[model samples]
Target: MDRISDFILPAVIICIVGYGFIKKAPVFDLFLEGAKEGLCTSVQILPALVALMTAVGMIKASGALDSFTYALRPVAALLHLPQEVLPLALLRPISGSGALVIFQDILRQYGPDSLIGRIASVMQGSTETTFYTIAVYYGATKVQKTRHTLPAALTADLVGFLMSALAVRLLLP
Candidate 1:
């Protein structure tokens, strides 16, 4: 399996180049053009990405995240979520790396076999960094009026968080 996987990418690349040659396509020029466009897209989104990262850093540094997690404890309890995982849930939508740090802390504090660890692991897989995604993709595309995107993405994140806890509970012995 490992040997086959190692050749998979090379095989695909070889097939693509072969097909391009057979079709008389400028494969190298096309590749360069695609790379240039990707670079332009990265440049276009850089401001939004920087702004989002700065905002996340500020929120974390100001202790606002912890305060918000504390405020959400009652709601979490009502939903039968472990209070320890509240920070991970709250941070998951804003910053993937930040949520990852919180997730790691959860695993370290509770161990991977524990309920909190399981739920956190599930959430890490299920949810997304909504704000970061919106910032990059919308910024790259120059989308001005994101009328329903934010709310819809947030709703999905909430479902992911809740479902992560519920699924773990159901599957546990």
Candidate 2:
């Protein structure tokens, strides 16, 4: 299985190049064009990315995240969520890397086999970086108004967080 998986990518690449050759396509030129377009898209989204990152940094540095987490503790407790993982749950939607750092801290402090660690791990897997994703993709597409995307995506993230905890509780011994 491992050997087959290893060859899968090379096989796909070879097939693509072969097909291009058989069709007399300018594969290299096409590749270069695609790369250039990708670079342009990256450039277009750079400002959004920068703004999102700056906001995340400011929220963290100003202790807003911690305060928010603290404020949410009662709600988390009401929902039967582990208090320690609240920071991760809050951060997951905003920034994946930031959530990952908190997830890592949870794992190190609680150990992966522990219930809080399991819940955090499940959350990290299930949730999306909602704001970052919206900023990049919408920014690249020059979308000024995100009519329903924000609310829908946030609802999905909320479900993911709730289900992550519920799943860990129900499925794990």
Candidate 3:
């Protein structure tokens, strides 16, 4: 099933290309042009990608992420959450890819039965990538700056993490 997903989109694209070629459709030129546009897109996105990575690196290098995890420990205890999830809570808000990586690590460690495993899965499912959102929003628009950008994004991610856990508890046993 998983491999099917890996193959599906490429398979479809190949089919489309083959059909276009057989039918003598104008798709070859269009495809080449599309490929050029995609290269342009990759170039355009490099700045945002670099910026997001740098920000994530700085956050991790500073003690803030550790402090945030430490702060979450008490709440985790009160909620009977597995201690492992404390670091996840901190990661979930700031970096989406990092959180997903950590989520997979928790899943591997606890085999999905552990409280942290289930919660990490839920958090990974529910949360959006904050920097990705900001980048896309800013990239598409002409806005130079926005007020409360960091605070709003962090708040959304925080609320999403809480709700993911709460929803799992209420809905999933």
Q: Note the Cα lDDT for every prediction shown.
A: 0.91, 0.91, 0.78
| C-alpha RMSD of candidate 3 | 3.4
Error of 3 at 141 (Å): 5.6
lDDT of 3: 0.78
Where's the lowest-lDDT run of ten residues in candidate 2? Answer: 137-146
| Model 3, runs deviating above 4 Å | 15-24, 74-83, 140-142, 146-156
What are the root-mean-square deviations of the candidates from the true structure over C-alphas? 2.5, 2.4, 3.4
Q: Write the per-residue lDDT of candidate 2 for residues 54-109, one digit (tens) a residue.
A: 99888878888899889999999999899999999888888788888999999999
Best by TM-score: 2
Kindly list the per-residue Cα lDDT of model 3 for residues 59-144, writing each as its tens digit.
87887877877777888777656678777777766677777787888899898866667888887787777777787567545566
The best candidate by lDDT is 2
Where does candidate 2 clash, by residue pair?
Answer: none
- TM-score, each model? 0.88, 0.89, 0.74
